[model samples]
Target: MYRKEFFVFEQGRPVSALIRNYERKDFPELIRIQQECFPPPFPSELWWNREQLDNHVSLFSEGALCVEVNGEIAGSMTGLLIDFHLDSPDHTWEEVTSNGYITNHNPNGNTLYVVDISISPSFRKLGLGKWLMSAMYDLVIYKGLTRLLGGGRMPGYYKYAHKMTPEEYIASLLDGQLKDPVITFLLHCGRTPIRAVANYLEDKDSCNYGTLMEWKNPFHQ
Candidate 1:
């Protein structure tokens, strides 16, 4: 764990924490945190099931990230690298598998994508989210990927952010909610929304989601 210290003059206090890259061994812990935060988070076993992940999708590696305050998992984030040029229909696992056929719509650009990010309830309000974003941004840039893409729901919190509560929030977000806050947050760290598409899955209960955002690292931009 790497430690950093900062002084808050307004609060008249000193703050500290350990920030580090996650490992495959951390998947179980990551699942635990996700269960605590997301309504229908993925199970711990799924992280190790590459065969279960859609071929078009890439799973997070051991190098994701974790933030600890005094030695506990306060937050974690996951990212993936995808061929942005591929226009493959991004659908849920059940939807595509049920069809018995996978379609490919490769669009033609290379980009790094952020798949998930979360902070434990106790760690909210701190700069932990921003910390994860900054770390992911740097990691993506380090790989020399020209663009970064990812999306989630609006308003931030899943329950209040959407018409549906936790279930809707999770479905919309993980299942492709494609809201503006996702674009806004990416932009805050230097990203831009480029296009929108309908929900990749035709599931009746799935929220419509189809916005693809891009952020060229300023250095690359």
Candidate 2:
């Protein structure tokens, strides 16, 4: 693994790690992380499968990044170019990602669409996921994209699936009266949830629904 000292603050203390470009050698740990993080029917297998990961890396190498801690792959992120000008409202996750193959990446597109962002179970609470997102932001600025958008799985929704609509559940969490382990973390990282998308993925934990989230880069704006 390529190593470099990259540090970030966590609770007023400096933490050191290595953040770098994705490589085929990282696939073993990447797949392990994916298996530990996502649940059934979510297509987590493709998250780090050699063919799928290579498809994305070969298409836009710079769009993917990894975080290494203690000589292990702790986190990873992946995205592809998209054209927001031609976008329609409520696009399904399958449609956005070409049924999870990510074969629709447009090289000249103006928007950077995040396809995946995952941290290994062992690396949670270390601020690695947030750091991964920051790396993505750096790439977005470099790519000259106007904005970043993606469908975020609302894992919290499953618990109350039969009790409330996705919006109500999100509102309760947004109001700070309820807590959702996954969405709460993403919300804290500056991603804005725009609307809820049903059948966004086959994720049982999310009730097959995801929140369409966005982050507008003022630098690009």
Candidate 3:
């Protein structure tokens, strides 16, 4: 997969990139970006490996996307459709993703499951994350899904973990003065926290808890 180099400098820094469907050749860069977004003690197993990522891209090519900035993969996002009943029981990341292959992806499902959305460390604060999330919304509407459902990491909970339960932490973040960098941004995108999903991953930063977030397509009904 050969890519032509292109650069656009603004104030001594590269500009935000465009989001596009994931390519087979971007897997290596995607793996690297995952490493940079997450640090040590956060088991590598928590992330999608080469084979798993390849499987995801193969199964749902349109759902997998990469952000290219200065000819580099600066961020990426992956998703799949699933059948979910809001009144039914809770779900774990594993149950929905089948450990990341998304083998359970239902083509006629009503919900869009966002498997992962990450940005390169160097590309932080570039609004790339927001762009990727917005793209997910576009996908749901385009595919005519009823809603979007997925785990939202409580990255800011690490600092408050010892003092607060996952529920309380998220409650504070949503209702109180607490502002979580990730959760807040997702909420701003029209997704609401549905519940606390336990053991979403080995993320110490999020206290191993993830919020079940949802966004209904207003245009659906």
For each candidate, give its TM-score against the true structure: 0.61, 0.86, 0.86
Residue-pair clashes, model 3: 0
Tens-digit lDDT track for model 2 on 1-221? 22346875657777678888888877787788888886666565455578878887788778778888756788888888888753465778778877556799999988889888888776786888887777777777777788788888887788898989999988988899788876888788888888888888888889998888777887875
lDDT (Cα, 0-100) at 116 in candidate 3: 83
- Summarize candidate 1's per-residue lDDT along 187-219 as a digit string, tens digits: 555555554444533322334443455667767
The local lDDT score (0 to 100) that residue 37 gets in candidate 1 is 76
User: Which regions of candidate 2 deviate over 4 angstroms?
Assistant: 1-4, 8-15, 39-47, 85-87
Cα misplacement distance, residue 34 of candidate 2 (Å): 1.9
Residue ranges of candidate 3 with Cα displaced over 4 Å: 1-16, 161-165
At residue 72, give the lDDT of candidate 3: 78
Best-to-worst TM-score order: 2, 3, 1
Better of 1 and 2 by lDDT: 2
